[model samples]
Target: MSGALAVIGLGPGSPQTLTPEAAAALDRADALYGYGPYLDRVPAKSGQTRHASDNREEGSRAAAALRHAAQGAKVAMVSGGDPGVFAMAAAVCEQIDRGDAAWRSLDVSVVPGVTAMLAVAARVGAPLGHDFCAISLSDNLKPWGVVERRLDAAAGAGFVIALYNPISRARPWQLGKAFERLRQHLPASTPVVFGRAVGRPDEKIGIYSLDAVDPSAADMATLIIIGSPLTRVIERPGRSPLVYTPRFVEGGH
Candidate 1:
């Protein structure tokens, strides 16, 4: 409970998704910072300073939280999904490495939480039970050329792709280009899933063929899961459909 900073994962939104460790860390924090919308999911309590942001300037907020911790405050940075999966934990670490003396003075830790990909995969049964990979379609930090290369490689590797930051208002066409690159290595009939605002209210989960998905339908909050050619989506008679990519067959006929 000493003055330290921790990047806490609150999970997709459900209290059930929150790990006991993350809950305990949050309970011990004197202050918390997170995206504005995620703040509503956390109940307010006296003496707990909550800093909300528009989610764009996560770096600056994380830097400030580090400062608070250095000043003897138990600062916990909260993320909607897992912190290291395109979230604030890495940002804080980056700032610390870049000579933020205050941040270096404090003990920092990243607590894992349920990410969108995991939540989506769980909702769909197990689309990513086999070998998989993740990428961010946004070119904010990395160039499109680099992103394209990685996408193509992942596709050819037959890895289930969990695409983060797939689309946003400013970069609406990024996902389209990424899918195009991937298409070169994957079949059109491959199973694909779009999980919008996953684990939160207004969450929309859809499974379809890769060729049938429209990138325009995706938004910044959406997480896309494009499966390998071996993947399939099955509709059940009385339950929610399931997604799976067969790993192996016991017998070859």
Candidate 2:
């Protein structure tokens, strides 16, 4: 009797944003495994066990969760935002691909939740209304050159870019470098949004032009959206400005 493994997304950072399906999956889990901060998001259950690890231990954490599930104990691997979006789902799948046959045999499911970019986009209108692509600025897993190339290609092709894992203490300069790269392809007046800890108490969403935007304003918790030339900003009398990209582009279908 193989047990199940559920990769659950806890949404951005708000309990109110957690999906019903994710809540039920968490309820059914006999054990949970995830990064310390993300594991802290899920309320504790009476008999359920939690195994918390460092944020960088995705591979080992996935393996441990799979091993637990293979022993007939229902396990949930938790992630912040949507599990499939540069999160635990890919880690779990990678482990399964190279892991034991029993690990592969375990029943697995991924429960979706609101990812950071979507949450940020909703808070400030839809910059994602047009064609968009997400790229992680972190070079931990891949080469920095790959990130640079993707940024160039995405910007050159006029795709609105959503940057994840933008900056940290160790890699403080990359976001600035990214801004520089974008400036080569985009207008100085292009809209850029820095959404930090969105949906949480300390949430901060700042709208800036590409030339005036400061990379130091963002951290690992921030999700930055770089709008295309067609993106517009609408002002209201007493409300925050709305930022959106028109669905229809000029001259092409």
TM-score of each: 0.93, 0.99
Instruction: Find the candidate with the highest TM-score and give its number.
Output: 2
Model 1 compared with the native: what TM-score? 0.93
TM-score (C-alpha) between model 2 and the true structure: 0.99
Off by over 4 Å in 1: 249-253
Q: What is candidate 1's lDDT per residue for 1-253, written digit by digit as tens?
A: 4579989888887888999999888888899888887777778879999998877887788888888888889988999889988898888888898856656768898999999899988888888877899998878888888998898888988789999988888888888888777778888888889888766678898887777778988887788899987888788999878999787634644
Alpha carbon deviation, residue 66, candidate 1 (Å)? 0.9
Model 2 Cα lDDT, one tens digit per residue, 1-253: 7699999999999999999999999999999999999999899899999999999999999999998998899999999999999999999999999988777778999999999999999999999999999999999999999999999999999999999999999999999999999999999999999999998999999999999999999999999999998999998999999999999987978
lDDT scores for all predictions? Answer: 0.85, 0.96
Task: Candidate 1: give its CA RMSD in angstroms.
Answer: 2.3
Q: How much does each candidate deviate from the true structure in C-alpha RMSD?
A: 2.3, 0.7
Off by over 4 Å in 2: none
